[model samples]
Target: MHEVKKDGILFHRFDHLGHCDRLCHGVFTRQGGVSAPPFDSLNVADGLGDAPAHVRENRQRILRATGGTDLMWMRQVHGTRVHIAEKGAATGTPVADALITAIPGLLLVVQVADCQPVLLYDPRRHIAAGVHSGWKGSVANILGRTVAGMISEFGCRPADILAGIGPSLGPCCAEFRHYQTELPEAFRSYKGPRSHFDFWAISVDQLCRAGLQKDNIEVQKVCTRCHDDRYFSYRAEKITGRFAAVIGLSPPQPT
Candidate 1:
């Protein structure tokens, strides 16, 4: 992922999806905002103890930075639930971990802190999706579900889908002490030393198994715990802010 700056806001764009004029997507970092310490600057998640006004302001900043008309996000519950956003759809906060849309100007947002913000775009179909996947979400194979939803709902082919796994808890810091029970037997194969797990590999494997070509998936490989300076990490700080990862079709260009 390469960093893109807009209006003092910093975010990352997938190399595969970066040059496409039909879409605008970003994996925002925890920088340039009005919130105070702990939630210092650019905290977008609500009901997490941050002031509502600050969250609203941060969200607006993101909206402006990404050049999106309206935003669609959810109360991510680390489950396999997926929501489909359409043109002229009412913006309501649903309880789901993934949101997909083919509508231009409707930005799909996902909040993250020590979790993967998976963004998918199919240029062939002009479809985009934002997913919030943590360790629990990985276990549930939310990536597969989201891709399947796109295939069924939007006629998007998996091979044409470009996926980007944003900065999150890398294997270096993704330690799981209770893997014996918390994780299934199949997951143990991906375990590293000291009970740490490489979720990046897991996500990539999941995407490939879901029918996307290996080249189409891009993993940022940024560990939130290691780069807490630029990102928020729940493992590093229990009460931290959640950064934003947004994807949307660019508004129709003037004729």
Candidate 2:
């Protein structure tokens, strides 16, 4: 992943998708905003007890940094629902954990605190999706489902899609004490030292199962819980804000 700084704002981009001239994508950090403590700066989720005004400002900063026209995201219920965000299809934020879209200039966002945010794009089909894959969502393979949706809904091939797994709770801090009941039996193998789980590997495996080439997937090893100074972490701070992982197809360039 390439770290980018624009003005005073900073964010990260996947190397696989970095040279794309028609893609606007970023995994933003908690910096360069106008919010107060707890939600201090760069918090994009308004529903998480942050002032709507601050959230709006923070979101605007992201838009300015990426030069994306508009941003849209779901309510993110940690479910497997994959909502299509094509132009003029529907209004309001849908209650889903993932958003798929082919609309140019519209950014698809996945807001997260500790949950993994996955950004995917099919350069061949000009389609993109943002996925919110928490432990529950990952157990259910929401990321795989999103890739499947892109294939069925937008005629996108998984092999042509580039994926980026953003910062989240790493194997070091993802301690699940009651994994025997909480996590499914399959997750036992991904356990790190103690009870921690390597969700990054799980996501990569999910993408591979969905037929995406391993070379097209970029995983940022930075853990949100471990690097709470750069990112917001729900486990580290019970009352914190959610940062955004955004992806969109830029408007067509003049030939």
Best by lDDT: 1
Each prediction's whole-model lDDT (CA): 0.92, 0.90
* Tens-place lDDT digits, model 2, residues 24-97: 99899988888888997789988778889999989988987886788886898888899999679646899999
Candidate 1: segments with Cα more than 4 A from true spot: none
Model 1, 18-90: lDDT tens per residue? 9888998888889999999899889999888999999999999999999888888799999999999865664
Query: In candidate 2, which residue pairs get closer than 3 Å at backbone N, Cα or C atoms, i.e. clash?
Result: none
Q: TM-score of predicted model 2?
A: 0.97
> What lDDT is obtained when candidate 1 is compared to the true structure?
0.92
Taking all chains together, each candidate's TM-score versus the true structure is 0.98, 0.97
Which residue pairs clash within candidate 1?
none
